[model samples]
Each structure stands twice: as C-alpha cells, then as structure tokens.
Target: MTSRYLDYSGNMDGELRMPGKDKHFQNTEDRTDSGLDSLKDEDYNRIVSGVQNLCIPVSATPQDYEPEPWKVQNNEDGDTLLHLAVIHEAKDLAEEAIRRSYRDGYYLNRQNNLYQTPLHLAIITEQAEIAEKLLQAGCDPEIRDYRGNTALHIACQRGSLRGVGVIVQYSKFQLPSLLTCYNYDGHTCLHLASNNGYLAIVEHLISLGADINAQEPCNGRTALHMAVDKQNPDLMYLLLKHGADVNKVTYQGYSPCQLTWGRENSQIQQHLLSVTEKSLQYLPESEDEDSSDSESEHSDDEYMYDDCKLMCQGLN
Candidate 1:
C-alpha cells in the first residue's frame, strides 16, 4: 500500500463567491446558484437550473449553522455517493451531478475518504467511459487522493488496460509524471503494478509511453528493483521487454540484477542480463528533459515517443 496523499483544502471559504461573503458557509446553495447563473451556455444554464431544482435537501442550517467539511455525504468506507457513482457507473446520477458541478463550475473534486474523485471511482468500478468523460470535463488528473495515488496511479494499480486507455486518452497526461507519483512508501506506479504482478497494466502503461527506467524517489529504486527484489519474474520480463534499463544502479549502486545475485536468484539475474543487452542495443527516446544521446545509455533499436510518452516500441 502506498501513502495516500489525502489532504484536501480547495474551494473552501475564500475560494468561493457568495452574496453573504461575511458568512463563509452561506456560500453553499444560494451563492452557488448565483455562480451557476453566470454561465453563458444555455445547456449549462439548464444544468444549473436542474441542479438547483434537484438540490439534495440539506438539513435546515440554523441561522447559526456552520459548515464542517466532513458533513459532506459519504457511502460505505466513507466514499461519497459521487465517488461511488463515477466508479460504479451510476451514470444517471453521475451525469446529473456532473452537469450540476459543471454548471456550478465546481465538479472538479478529488476529496474522498482516499482523496479520490469520481474519475478514480469510475476506474476502480471498471467504468472506462465515465472516466473518459470526467477527463474531458477538466478533472485534475494529477490529484492524488489519500493513497498518494493519482487516478492514473490507481488505474495502473488496478492493472486494467481499458481503464489505463481511458486515462491515457487525455492529451495533458504526462507519462513521466507516473514515474514520480509515489504511494506512501514512495513506490511509483511501475513499482505498484510490478510488485502486484499486474502485467497487463504494466504493459499497457509502458505502451502508453511510461518511462521504463524512471527512478522512484525512495532510495532511487526503479520498478525493476521492486519486481526483482520481490521475485516477480513475470514483472521482470514485462519491464525488460518494455525497455527498462537494468544496468542502471539504485542510490546504493545496486541494479535489479544485483538483488537477484544477493538472493542467488539465477532466474532474475538471467532475465536482467537478457534485458540489459536488449536495452543497450536499442535505447528508447522520450521528448522530455532527458531525451538527448548524452542522457541515453546507448544507441536504441527503434523506440519512439511522441509529444507525450507514447509506447510506440512495437509499432515502430
């Protein structure tokens, strides 16, 4: 399990606009309605109207009522209905809430029990389309819920190609960012999928252009380090086939093969050697800060990455 980076402090009192600016909590319904009324599009207008028309009844706030963030609704395990709706494909509710949030210009949220949004919920629930819709709706893909896992992080953790596909569709999705995204212990998405033996997600992410040799913040370990140390051969093969740099040393200067040697794991050692040879022959190229030959360890075979990281290894 990774560290859940679940700190939520957005659109609070000052971030919102309300008639009664003096009363921060009053920004709830009345002020929210006013904001919705400002949208220029008619469709957007109707959405706000519908949302106000269907406002979930809040217990009458006393004139002295104050808002507590926790007072927001939650489902089992403390997931909000919105959280469950997107993930579980409760579309009618999802769409309606989505529309309302958009109309109100406040749908972008990732503050659930695990600091996840409806988009992440959709991924967890296997609702790829809903996740796609949410991305197009301008949700923050970088938001890490309580688990220090972004929606991309969770989709990779789930190891579902379809879910990863939906996430990868976003043009702004920075594949290299996944390398930096860490769970509490500082393992990257690659580390998570590899350690869990989720080969599909691992491959899909690699295909979508994740950096195979990217280092995790904790101890500067790469995904290969985690997989080999954990004795996951399937993961080792996947990472190697996808072009992970096996020779690269961790902070302690130990490569994935070193772990295998320490444990006398011949199987892993052989796999690393094979992959390292392949990587040396054909290093991959990404269009990020580290693309030049100086950064590249050796001449690559034919790995190609577009504007964002595109796992175009096989295609090329």
Candidate 2:
C-alpha cells in the first residue's frame, strides 16, 4: 500500500492531464460556444423583427392614437395644446381639439400659467371664427384671466366688433350678466369700449343688453363719466343717446357733467350740462373744500411741529 501511494504522488504531473479531465474541459468549451451561438441567433431575430415592423404599413385611426386633452400641456407656460394651436392660428387642430374636449369642462376651460384659456387667446389673436367655435363648443365665456378680463372684455378692448358679436351670439343666455362682468381694473365690456372710444362697439354692447350706466367699481365712474374724462364728444353723445344717466356720480360725488368742467371739449361739456340735473351740475363744493382744508391744516401742523423741534435742537 505504501508503494502504491508513493507512486501516485510521484506521477501527479502526468495524472493531471488524464483523459477524464481533458474530456470535461472539452465539454465546457462546447457548451460555451453553443450558448454564444444561441444568443447571437436571438439577437439576429430581434433585429429582423424590428426592421419588418418598420417596413410594414400599419393603418390606424386617429381615435386610437389621440392623446387625452388634459394630458397635453406645455411644461413651461402650462399652455394646453389648444392654447398653442389657437395662438398659431392652427384652425383645424384647434377645432379638432375643441370637438374632442368640448364636454370636458376642465380641459376646454383649462387656464394656462397666465390664467388665459384658449378662448382668451383666440380673441387676443383676433381669431373671431375660433372664438365662435369655442363658444359654440360650450367654453365658458365668463372665465377671467390673471387680470380678471374675460374673452368678451378683451374683444371690447380690442374693438373687434366681429369678436364681440360672436361671443354675444353664442352666449345669449349669459349676455345680461356677461356684459356687466368687470375686470380687475373695474371695467366692464361697455366701459372698455367707451374708454377706448369704440363707439360702434359701445352701441353694439348696449343693444345686446350691456348696462349703459354701469359704473367702475374702483371710482364709481360710469361709462358716461369716462367718456367725458376722455373728452370724446362722439362717445359722450352715444352714451347720452343710449340713456346713460348724466347725474350718475363718482364715489367722490363728481358727476359726468362735473368731470367735463375743465375739459376742452365744450360740446361734450355743454351736452352733458344740458342733460344733467341742475342740482348735480356743480361739484359738492362745501364737502370737498372742508376735506381739503382739513388735509392742509394737518400738513401745516406737522410742518410747525418740525420747525419747533429744529429750533430746540439749534438752541441745544
């Protein structure tokens, strides 16, 4: 037994290259090659399939691929696709989007980062047809922007008679309230038209039931008051013709005729004077004089106190 063990150790180098070990190594190389070839085949199949798909003509309906309107918004300005479409005057795309999302109030009326809806941009861009489509699609007419201006307010500001007509025509039921809607600057659609001397627009708005005598919330100045302030005789006459209240006064109790006092448009001033009540023709002199006197007295007292303080400091 000792002789056999010693012989085995002595033959270690030769035993390592025995047939069984050589066979095992050969099998491993064959299996590795087979695995690599299988991987290559799979990769080739994938490449071929991708190319086939690219070359094949696949017919699909628009409804199958159209993205949800609510999900399509600009990352920077929060403008919906409809907003950009309207801005660029892409009538077809804008109309299609409107048709798809008209019933989706949250989408159709969605406001951008600037608080402008597609309807607002439509009128801003002077796309009266698009504005009409939006209105007909049930887009809200009274939605306000960051400046609290509705699309109708902008139309009036721009003096777009067509735009105004479209908005009013589609929003007939909301006309009474929409015409009186005020922006953050306290201007109704009628006020904006009057202030900007859009005589035709003013008349159209009035005929559509806009309040002729609507007053600005900031100063209680009526459109008539604004007309006189701007010295626009034509606008003033239009207001009068439409039955604007001449006696309607500002928060400070200054009537339209009173506002015309220093204006150079004598025609405006005299006409307003003719229609204004005699009692309101003159400014409330006593009240204004008393308030001004009190302010002057308070300022005088502050000045006297400061003079006295300086005198004491100089003496010290």
Candidate 3:
C-alpha cells in the first residue's frame, strides 16, 4: 500500500511531492507528520471509523458511538465531523460528534473555510434540532460568521424562533447584550425579526426584554420603523403594544406615521393615528389648562378690539 500524508491544510499527497508542499509530510528522519506509523492499529482504525461515521447521510439512522480518534481527520475545508454532520442534517451523527468532542475535549467551535462553525451551519440550514445539539455541546453561539452575524442573528433573520430559544436557553451569552448586538450592517436581532415580519420571534424577543425601540446604528431605524415600512399591520400592532414609540423618527427625521403618508397601509396609518391620539390624551393637565386659559383671553381681547373699532367707525 502507498503511504500518504494528510497535511494540516487538508491536502493529501503521495510520497512523491514538491519540496515546499512536502514540508507538512515528513521523512523517517524528521518525523514531522505526527508519527502516523507509531499509532496502534486500533487507534488508526478508530480514526478512520469516525470519518466514515460522519460520511453517513442525514437520512440514515447512525448508531450512537464516540469517535474519539476522528479528531485527526478532516476534509479539505477544515470542517470537522461536527461541521459535516450539521451541514448534512445528520442528527444522529451530529449528536455523536458532540459526544466525542465533549468526551475528548475537542474544539466544536472550529470555523470552516467560510468562517462558520457547526452552530452557524445549523442556523443557516434552519435545523433547530441540530442547533440544539450544538448548543447542548456548549458550542459558542456568539461566534460571528464571515458575514459578521452570530447564530442568534441568523436565527432572527431566518425566523427560527425555536433555534433562538435554544441558543438563548443553552448558550451563556448575556441576553441583553446579545439582543443589542448589531451586525456589520448595524442591524440588531430585533431589527431583523421586525423587517422579516417574524411576529412570534419579535414577541419572544420583546418578552425577553429585547429593546423594542432599538435603533439600527447606520440608519437609525427602529423595529417600529421597520414594521411600518413593511406595511405589516400585525407587526405594527405587536410593536406598538410592546411600547414601540410610534412618534420616534429615524435619521431622515421620518417618524413611523411620516413613513406611512401616501402609502397604501391604511391599517398601519390608523393604528399609528390611534396610538398618537391616545398618547396626546395623556398630556399634562397643567399644559392643557394653560392653553385653554390663553385661548379664552385671546377671545376676550378680540371682542374688545372689535367693539372699539365699531364705535370708531360709527363716529366717523
């Protein structure tokens, strides 16, 4: 059998290789290849077996087992067995991958070519159960992907409320900080949820004390602003009910009602109007009484001026 070497870069080469490429592969003198021949047959077999376990498709039911030795093997993309299992939606294999990592103290938070961990893959694929598995294995949900979005951010954008719940429940991230975390584009999880009309997620986030009036850093648009722009009455109602300030303006100085002008969103317009009226009703009584007294005094002055002008006209 030909002897092959797996490089740290995930490239496999035969004994004959270019000089620089062969640096990862070693001769009997340097022994830099991590001593492939020194390992017992059982250890090598276990390593190969773990790789094969990860190769199992998601549709098939894989038996539960720990792949302690599979740590040595990874595909060309730097994706470990856990990353592959999550990508393939292989629930059983994914669970086993978590088990192996936990038992052997392996890194489950490793990033792939795209800078995505297994948890990121799970959220992208909308596989809530698989995400739960990764969380259970103590994968860091706060890891940002190449797009600068955490798994929780993806969950909100993808409308995976269950995944969000799993991440919040299992991950050690502070809820307030995570909720306020902005992506590269200055969008918080609440902004994504509102823009996508994920009402349930929005409600859940609000219940968890997510800032209903949280503004995007770049545009200064709040969740209420997003709800109005999307013309989603239900979202508007939900946001307003949660105390989203309808009168709050964006960087463009456009309030939620201002954004509704000339649009076809009558329901949202009416809702904003109603909320605004109710808010106005709560104005301080001192201010209202002062305005009323000023109005009456102005009326009396106008009447006296009119009487004096009539007498002057009659004399003339």
Where does candidate 2 stray beyond 4 Å?
A: 1-70, 284-316
lDDT by residue for model 2 (202-261), tens: 998888888998877645788888887788888888888888888887766788887765
For each predicted model, how many residue pairs clash, with residues at least 3 apart or on different chains? 16, 0, 0
Give the candidate order by descending TM-score.
2, 3, 1
* Model number with the top TM-score: 2
In order, candidate lDDTs are: 0.62, 0.76, 0.73
Q: At residue 204, give the lDDT of candidate 3.
A: 92
Instruction: Rank candidates by lDDT, best first.
Output: 2, 3, 1
Tens-digit lDDT track for model 1 on 1-316? 1222211232222222234343333323454454655566676656645533442233323463443453366766766656767665678888766654442213356476666777767878888877777777667677776656777777777777787777777734565675466665455777677777888877766776666787755356788888877888778777777777778876645667655643556787776666564433232244233646423532341222121123221222
Predicted structure 2: clash tally: 0
Model 2 worst lDDT run, 10 consecutive residues: 1-10
